[model samples]
Target: MITYIEELTDQEREAIREAIQLLYRQTYLLERRYDRRTEKYQYTKEYRTCSTHLEFLKDYFAVAGISLEENVHDGIIYIQGETLWGEKLPRLATVYLLILKLIYDEQMAQAASSTRIVATAGEINQKAGAFRVIKSIPSPTEMRRTIALLKKYQIVEPLDILEELNENTRMIIYPTVNLVLSGDHIRELLESFSEEENSGEETAIQNTIEDLSE
Candidate 1:
């Protein structure tokens, strides 16, 4: 593994180092080159570098009991390992994630015939409101932060940032959102939400990362 890593130029080595740091920090890496909606960037080249030196990554992560995974089809790379309940998303982020997963699933199932699901900020707000996942549309600042967080996690892609936080602002919620919440988890969440709706105990909620054992 060291042999391969040592063969790379200093710049390539730095790029790989940065990529690994990012993966460890966010646990997800999405190659912009793979996204048809975005232009190419240095990330894809760096991603290839890591891919070429995959053995190094595997060996490095194995010590920590983390698995380095890549899906060429999805254009995403991620590190999967143990997760603590306390390490999970805050209530607001978790709620938004669930809502986006639901939207992605619904869109894929219909006659749309497209794997990609495009939704406007207003549509998300309306659907989330209808499901009572949130009391109201998140404030612009809050949504901006949430979107940033999601983008970092390879969950969503926003085409334009100039006119963000508005009703017409469109974003592409990736299929990775589905990975965050398994089908069973989604069912459990919906069931829990429904019971809360009847019982008026919206405050009671489950932690997503609680079940992940590292």
Candidate 2:
């Protein structure tokens, strides 16, 4: 390992440093991965760095319990660390993550391709409604705050400004959302949410009735 690290040229070493930092910070590298759009715009030269040295990165990160995953088919390069902060995600964010995954899976089932899954804020809200999860959608400010948390991990990326959000406010829901939470786990959350939503609605209705009686 020492010999291999020594063999790396200054440029290669720099690329490794940037890639490691990117994965450590973002958890997923989408814009950095090679894709059709990456080629069309002819992005900055940093984007041109080939993944030929990825194997070295994999071996190196393993020392720190991080696994560098490269999926050309999915057009993503991400890392999975043993001590990742998956358990710290808030329940609200988890529900949103599951909803996004459900949306992505539904879309993928209908059409299979490398193309990104686009979901509008309305669509996510609708899906949450359909699943009978999240008794009430929080105010846009609170909702965006929750989403911003997931955004830090590169789970759901916004395509437009927060002001433009509505039924038509589209965002690219990354596959990493699924990686963070497994398929079976999401299904379980759905069932749990169903019960919670029902209870919450019943309580709200009873409170309203009591107010009317007074």
* TM-score for each predicted model, relative to the true structure: 0.76, 0.70
Clashing pairs in 1: 82-214
Report lDDT (Cα) of residue 61, candidate 1: 84
Q: How well is each residue in 1-214 modelled by candidate 2, as lDDT tens digits?
A: 7798689899887887776666665565654322234333222232234266677778887888988776766556667764653234555665677688888888888886656677888888777877777667657876777667766666776776666455676677876655555444455556566634434232110011122112
Off by over 4 Å in 2: 3-14, 31-50, 194-214
Displacement of residue 168 (Cα, Å) in model 1 is: 2.0
RMSD of each: 5.0, 9.5
Pairing residues by index, what is the TM-score of model 1? Answer: 0.76
The TM-score obtained by model 2 is 0.70
Give the distance in Å from residue 19's predicted Cα in candidate 1 to where it truly belongs.
1.2
* CA lDDT scores, all candidates in order: 0.65, 0.61
Q: Report how far residue 138 has shifted in candidate 2, in Å.
A: 1.6
